[model samples]
Target: MTVSPRNLRALWPLAPCACTALLCLCPALRGRGAEDGAGCGPLLKGSALLLAAGAGPPTLLVRPRSDYVCCHLALAVRLVPALPLGDALYLVPARQALWALDASKPEQRLLAWLRQQAPPDSCHLKCLQILKGLRDLSGRGLEGPLGAQWGRVLSSYALKTALFSVLLRGPWQAWQEQFLVERLEELVLYLRDCLRKRVLMHFFLGNPHVPEAVPVPRFLREAAPLNLLAAFDAATLDAAATQLLAAWSQAPKIIRMYSGPRHLRRSPALCRHVPEASQEAQSD
Candidate 1:
């Protein structure tokens, strides 16, 4: 349901869609309070509500033209109402001319990275699957330590960003079958660090490390760094860190539960190669 900014102009005549009223009812909107005036110019907070209210399926129209595309997107969490039993529309409003350019959207960036830089095998797919499996912990007792802020802080996209950051830094060769558990451990630790610092930076915005070949808008590169955790307060961050530390400690066992026998068998041997895992095991 993504459309060009011009398409949004068509809706300008429609009574502003009660974005404020709808947003007030959504707890998800409150987490992004810091994003106002921070680059994306405050998400069209409840625009997704408008789409959900329609008779058909839920449609979220994103205009990916500005620095906003580089930040976190937890659109699924924002849709309060259930829609018709059709596929959720996730359209990217790219013009035909811009198709050749690398997209700034996080999903597009991950896709491009997998095609161009990931190991030429199914290892990257396994890595993604492990991350996806970890997401099951979101609303469970473990994550409850973060209180009401769990949904905002540990969204699936946040985990993806952590993985994206790890891949960008390399040791790319370790993204193999043998290191699956260890890599999962690495990603968990990275997320713990982000929570500790209360700043999960948008991977593409103002990131000098992104490959030059990826066509980032000049404004995004020059814009102030976007902190996805900007709205987190001291208390929320403290609780988040505590919850993640517990997860980090249990990462291997938890991953073993979700992963296959191959990953399970490799865990001990793989821990030897990942320094942090080895140290944690010894301390345990």
Candidate 2:
């Protein structure tokens, strides 16, 4: 019988739940050299996060000001436990936010340290934010044809990998020099290349495609190759690519610098064509 993610989450009380699933599904996070039973059979060293936006808790009223709406359920590989789930808990996301609190705390010291060491206001984030917008627009268009569950070709996990790859290629100051339009163009160009090449190497997998400059720590390498884009079993790649190009071509050229609060976001106008879906959560 095929067990859904919801079914798996239902078994959380009986087992380690998401942690166990990660060990079984992702080669990088299974059977390693670490203590046994806290979650996995042993300590898995994989750095990838296999967060899926499943039909889990929807429209969760996290606080008065914010209603925590999960786009999907999450299944983080090695990092969820190592990084502490709280900070990454925003939402499983068909395309949405995540709160870091969702991570487990016991094994997150190193991951937390690395996060602190990253440049707080780096251009990497600036460009990443735009790419995220592009993804949201693309996903919005896909809600119907691909169905709510399988609409997107790219996931937040994949976008972060692409952004980190850019960071690896640079003198950080160089990004600041590029205009916002240039940044978008640069990112879109690279993504288009990845799509064409059919390779978006998992950052933590020690894949042959990972850039040498990226500098993934040895401990984070899971010794298993996990392709981040394996989620799509449909023709979503071509569809998403078409949406991306259209969005890139039609998006307004924002003149504001990456350093400010004044700006207008642009895209292929996914909402312009598709009606918004109801935000109701899946019922058990």
Candidate 3:
């Protein structure tokens, strides 16, 4: 059954009800875990604390500190199950690109102001690190109550990232600008694939009680490399990379007919769009 985007939106209202059912059905999906100690509870209590404490926007700009990472890991391990739905801080960094923040303060304000005026870089490695960390932690044999919690946390993060991408790319530029469109499309496909894998992992490893499991075919279709590659222009080696990412995203699970390794080993015939330098390198 094709799940239309409209149908997904329609399902939003039922989220609360679904969560309530999960709680009743799965006893393991309840209570805080070992990470939330006495002092930590009040310190990281609410979203208001982050905003009011002068913490900047919740983005990849924040650096991950030991304490902050510990706090997030705890929340994912503990608070995820009983509530099963809500935003939770996963990681925070100590420093950021000075430009990615408001430079109103006397201390680093000038630095931030200058950085914003500069041209944007292509790869934000800090953001990429956080994404990789999330993927690693979510797959690290975390199960039972903590698994459910981690699942919700990861899924929430994915959704937030998607929304942020949309906001950052805007409708006009997202469609018209080639580079921006490519970046945004890659991000969308990445997050969507992450959500699918995390959800499946949570159900298979963490909670057996989850009634409506996300279908494998649906995820495969959504993460299809060909479909994802369509977002890129007709030519370019990056198209293959896009396809690889899509396939890799679907590789973790045991899908009946898909042979991930075989696809990985066989290279597609180079299209005319391959760069001259790439062709030279391949020939050599």
Candidate 4:
């Protein structure tokens, strides 16, 4: 259950299988790493610093267009063949100030609990499709001139976590087509409240409401609930709240834009294949 710093190098082989490349998280930023410059400003404006495995002497600075850094991630699988679930726990770099000096101590010094959860139930695919559509539209500037402003404060993970929380508390039948609009409204409202309160708990950690089947680490079970919003500074938080309000007012239009006649015209077969089509287009 514990991986030494020396063996951390073994993880590199596995990285390329999942993503195009692996990037290291900055030891200085710890828990406060953002994908792009967003609101972090000039510090990440030009390049992302990726430290090599050992003593941080030789570093690689990638000048991606986004101007934000990626995080250090170690993948862990909790396989139970008999169960219907396939849970993956990602040991991301921790935020504690103490671990700021070392990136190699992933297992002991810098491990945070993040689970790649399975869908809540059989009904979740429809919910995921709806969520993914909203996200795709938002990236296309449905929420603002660019998604960067809101992206600075609110992450897609936060939104997904919120959606999962709702799914867990569901009556199961509320996910029907007739209640789709209401569900969307509720999800938006829930996110709005999280933005207002500046606290969104990670759905898997320290949650007793989670079913017995989901495997949570013992330390995380005892640890205080994590606030996903904790990374945002006061100014960025205020800006996020303001932008969310503006977006909330335009929610109807945004929803219409996504579920409108343009999308409605697509057959179920085409709709299901959107992810592949979009990926192929992106590659072109």
Q: For candidate 1, lDDT tens digit of each residue in 1-284?
A: 12355554544443343344334334444545465544222455323333334543245443333354544443543342211111211222233311111222445655685567666653555666666554455346653446567766776667767877887677767776677777777776788788888889876657777677666656456756777788678788767766655544445655666564666765654334334754576688
Poorest lDDT segment (10 consecutive residues) of candidate 3: 98-107
**lDDT, model 2, position 124:** 52
| TM-score attained by model 4 | 0.46
Clashing pairs in 1: 1-91
What's the TM-score of every candidate structure? Answer: 0.56, 0.48, 0.21, 0.46
lDDT string, candidate 3, 75-194, tens digits: 221112121122210111112321111101211232243234323542222233334444444446655543444443344333333433333343333333223224333554555454
lDDT of 1 at 135: 48
RMSD of each: 15.0, 14.0, 21.0, 16.4
Per-residue lDDT of candidate 2, residues 1-284 (tens digit):
02345644543353434444333334544554454534432222222223344455322111111123333433333223111122222112222332221212212342344345455444556666767765665455455554353333566657766765665565555455334455556677677667656667666554555444444445334356656556554355555555666555334432233334332443323223222331121111
Which ranges in model 2 have alpha carbons more than 4 Å from their true place? 1-55, 58-121, 143-151, 207-220, 231-235, 253-284
Arrange candidates by lDDT, descending. Answer: 1, 4, 2, 3
Question: Which residue pairs in candidate 4 have backbone atoms (N, alpha carbon, C) closer than 3 angstroms, thus clashing?
Answer: 36-68
Query: How accurate locally is residue 188 in candidate 4, as Cα lDDT from 0 to 100?
Result: 61
Give lDDT tens digits, candidate 4, residues 1-284: 12344654655455443321122233322223385525544444544545444332244443434424343422222211110011223333223211111112222221121122332333344444555555444545434333455653555567767777776667667755545556665676677678778888865456666565545556555656667788666666655655454444334445455455443322322222124555355448
User: Model 1: how large is the Cα RMSD against the reference?
Assistant: 15.0
lDDT scores in order: 0.56, 0.45, 0.32, 0.47
Q: Give me the runs in candidate 3 sitting further than 4 Å from their true place.
A: 1-4, 17-48, 52-230, 236-284
Q: Which ten residues in a row have the lowest lDDT in candidate 4?
A: 77-86
